[model samples]
Target: MLTFKVLAALLDYPNAETVAAIPEMRAILKAEGVDAPVLLLERLERGDLLDCQAEWVDLFDRTRAGSLHLFEHVHGDSRDRGQAMVDLAGLYGRHGLTVQASELPDYLPAFLEFLSLLPEAEARNLLGEAVHVVEALAERVGRRNAEYGLLLAIVAGLAEGPAKPVRLATGDMDEDIDAAWAEAEVRFGAGAALSGC
Candidate 1:
């Protein structure tokens, strides 16, 4: 599904390749009834490639609130998270999706790519696994007043079940982005390690 590809592109680090592909992706997403992503597409469209790349790094790479890796939201870098990664990678292999080492299996772009390989029902089923995480991230990104949150909401919308219950209090997470920027750059891990994860 091109909508999946569009989501993947938006979640990836934006660059000349990503910027150049925006128009066609926009058309595809619109045809797929995905209007929410257009907000992000518009941001990219208005900027030149460099500006878009900067925005991507600012919004995603630099902040936990807008992190693109799905597991970072839930698992962090705990052994559990690593195991989940291994299992997810195995699942992808079963489906014929090979992920490179540099790209974590839980990365949203890669996850969306995996979804693109499945039937809609199966895709929705798989997406349901991260509905709560997506919901929380959507709320966080929305608080930033960046329309990119809508893309996360769109991911949650793809799930089939009722909204998943979340124990984490996302309402009090006002400093997540600021806090993320303060910490040294650490990669994924559970608990406190998540700030950099």
Candidate 2:
């Protein structure tokens, strides 16, 4: 549904394009009866473009705690994450979605976009697999009082069952956490290492 796309857009890096889409996103959220994402949309609408972009970078780009990559929370920087990336890419392919080389399949915005193309029940069912990631991220972002948390809560709310509990590593410095969960490039196809698979 467009609601998923709107949520994805809100989660992505803000730019002039994102700002231009606010009215339509607001309308889509209202039409879908999803009220929470509208708060994020409204915040985006009110904030200065550069300030919004800077906040997004500070929260998502600079901190592992607010990362948009799903596997960052699930598998950290382990080799298994590479295989998971390949598998998720294959999943998208099966559904007729071609992920651009610039974006990882597990990136939250890309995943949400993938969901936007599916039947509502199928989308929610598929989202169930990542509910824990969404919930954990929501909790972390909410602790900072970020409006982005509302968007994640909306996603978590759409899942069919309770989220599995997640345990985040504690007592680590920010740089240490970033170093530990740092992202690695994912390659596809034969001789591509299957990402160490």
Candidate 3:
């Protein structure tokens, strides 16, 4: 639905395009009866774009807890996460949605976009499968930014059912936040040392 698309855009990093679209986004959300993000849209519209961008980076990019990648919370760098991403990407492809090379299929915004293309019941059912991740993200993000948390809460509400309780711990002071948030390198076909075997 358009509501999900609007919510997805709001969840993404704030940019000039998104900032400029605030009035239209607000209208879509209101028209869809999704009012949780109205205040967020108002704040974004009134705030400096640079400052809004900085806030988005601080919340989503700087910490594992606030990651926009849903699998980061679900699989946490495990090998399973890679396979899960592949499966999710395949799902998107089957549904005629092509994810960008730079964007993971499981990214929350992308996932929301996918939902926007599906029938309401099916969309809610799919979202329900990831409701725990959405709820966890809401808790983590809300703890730091209530507006974002509300957005995610609205997302979870659109799911088919309530999410189960999931406790996600925050990082410790001794942890290396940068390393924790670093992107893993993608390697081509064969192992570099395969000649030695």
TM-score of each: 0.82, 0.84, 0.84
User: Candidate 3 lDDT, tens digit per residue, 92-177?
Assistant: 99998888998898899989989999998999999998998888789878988998899899999899987766543333321364
Which portions of model 1 miss their true places by more than 4 Å? Answer: 168-197
Tens digits of per-residue lDDT for model 1, 1-197: 66777787777777767778887887887788777576677777786778767766777777766777777767654577788889999999999778997888988889988898889888888888778878888888777646677877887787778767755332346476358545665556567665645
Best by lDDT: 3
The superposed Cα distance between candidate 3 and the true structure at residue 158, in angstroms, equals: 0.9
Positional deviation of residue 57's Cα in model 3 after best superposition, in angstroms: 0.2
lDDT by candidate, in order shown: 0.75, 0.82, 0.83
RMSD of each: 6.9, 8.7, 7.2
Worst 10 residues of 3 by lDDT: 166-175
Model 2, residue 158: C-alpha shift (Å): 1.6
Which stretches of candidate 3 lie above 4 Å from their native place?
Answer: 165-197
Pairs of residues clashing in candidate 1: 76-189, 77-189, 77-190, 78-190
User: What is the per-residue lDDT of model 2 for residues 66-143, given as tens digits with 9 covering 90 to 100?
Assistant: 888998788877798899999999999999888898889999999998999999989988888899888878877777
* lDDT value, candidate 2, whole model: 0.82
